[model samples]
Target: MDSPSLDPAWTQRQRPPRLERRLGFADYPQVQNFLERLERLCERRQRYPDLGFGRTYVNLTIYPDQDATNVGDAEEDFARDIDGLLN
Candidate 1:
């Protein structure tokens, strides 16, 4: 699959092509809220990104779904939706 244009906040990585982004939160509660919202989003889209987090930040890695070698429109759109969650 070909890589699609991604949101500026996301970085495209090679090897096993994926999109990565780190989102910072003001505090633990904010991070918790973001995670909750992210869970809902994932359920709605049926796309889940690998996630890592701390008390104040979340690191997410979104991999191509079916292709396995490149990011496609679905992944790009999902990343964009996640960006929207922060706004």
Candidate 2:
């Protein structure tokens, strides 16, 4: 599938998608939802999880995890950082 030339509202200034969409759609919301869940269990830091222009599908685990350890000791900070990128 092809992506829109315009930027997606969920992510900041994204370029034209070069990755292939696995599910025949951008699936932006799906990926964003996963990121949201992940954000709930991480330290305060900058997140740059680029699932690649809708090229991938999210497979979330039913557990809490803090994978990114680059900020303080709160997931809120990381969430906010990722939130900024998402918007």
TM-score of each: 0.89, 0.24
Q: Whole-model Cα lDDT per candidate? A: 0.89, 0.36
The CA lDDT at 86 in model 1 is 88
What TM-score quantifies how close candidate 2 is to the native fold?
Answer: 0.24
For candidate 1, lDDT tens digit of each residue in 22-85?
9998899999999999999999988899999999999999999764668877788899899879
Output the lDDT of residue 80, model 2. 44
**Which 10 residues in a row give candidate 2 its minimum summed lDDT?**
13-22
- Worst ten-residue run, lDDT, model 1? 1-10
Candidate 2 lDDT over 1-87, as tens digits, reads 642233222222223312111222256776766556556533333333334334345421111134532322232333344334444
